[model samples]
Target: RVKIYEAMEAVILGADELDMVINTGNACAGKWDAVRKEISDLVTATPDTVHKIIIETCYLRDEDIIKASIAAMEAGAEFIKTSSGFAPAGAVVGDVGMIKQATKGKIGLKAAGGIKTLSNVLSFVEAGATRIGTSSGTSIMKEVR
Candidate 1:
């Protein structure tokens, strides 16, 4: 499948980390096994690379977000990411807390998408984000300075 190929390609290109988005439709439909299998496959395809499973929190309910995070962790991913940065909304603080609870410190947490300010980054970190992904790191730094 394309997901597997992308994982393989990332590894081939010397990518140390791979961020793969999960199928939100499956998760929303309660097809947890399928979601788990997809992530598991990608993890298998790139054993040497760190895998971050993006759950796209904007489309999911609180419970769904927790379930997705758990599935990703059980599937052998190293991190559970909040968004792909293409959704209408991304990386909410409440969602970050839910993911942290679901993961139980078993995996890393990344909060991404629309994180543009130092306050945003700090709030996410306070809410248990292990990593912060943003396109405005420089601007955030400028705010700090």
Candidate 2:
């Protein structure tokens, strides 16, 4: 279950943004309402902070990804992220594009996980990712320079 009070505690502790992972189990079980409700509650709990919901696309089918993206947008998430970077794979261009279509530009898109190069970053951006999360920032910056 989503912990609304704990999320509020983070806000009270001075966190300005939150990146939350949706329950992939519920999503895989085809519980769209549960998925949406959890995200909505989190958003409602911390209205002052930016909410970025990680759908963990690597574990989902294309249809699930699309559905999840739409649900997050409707639930008031500011961004729908591709992964938490702990999956078997990270963000992919195709997934990002699919998520973009599902959200219809109403919400932001973030590409995370395994993004290690400037080329990777550029590809995701071209695919409609508005934000990028990576651990290779230093190397990626070197590529830019």
Name the top TM-score candidate: 1
Backbone N/Cα/C clashes per model: 0, 0
Q: lDDT tens digits, residues 11-129, model 1? A: 89889999999999999999999999999999987898899999999999888998999999999999999999999998899999888987898999999999999999999999999
In terms of lDDT, the best-performing candidate is 1
Clashing pairs in 1: none
TM-scores of the models, in the order given: 0.97, 0.96
Residue by residue across 24-131, what tens digits does model 2's lDDT show? 999999999999999999988898789999999999999999999999999999999999988999999999998998777899999999999999999999999999
Q: After superposition, how far is residue 26 of candidate 2 from its true place, in Å?
A: 0.6
Summing lDDT over every window of 10 consecutive residues in candidate 2, give the lowest-scoring window.
1-10
Task: Estimate the TM-score for candidate 1.
Answer: 0.97
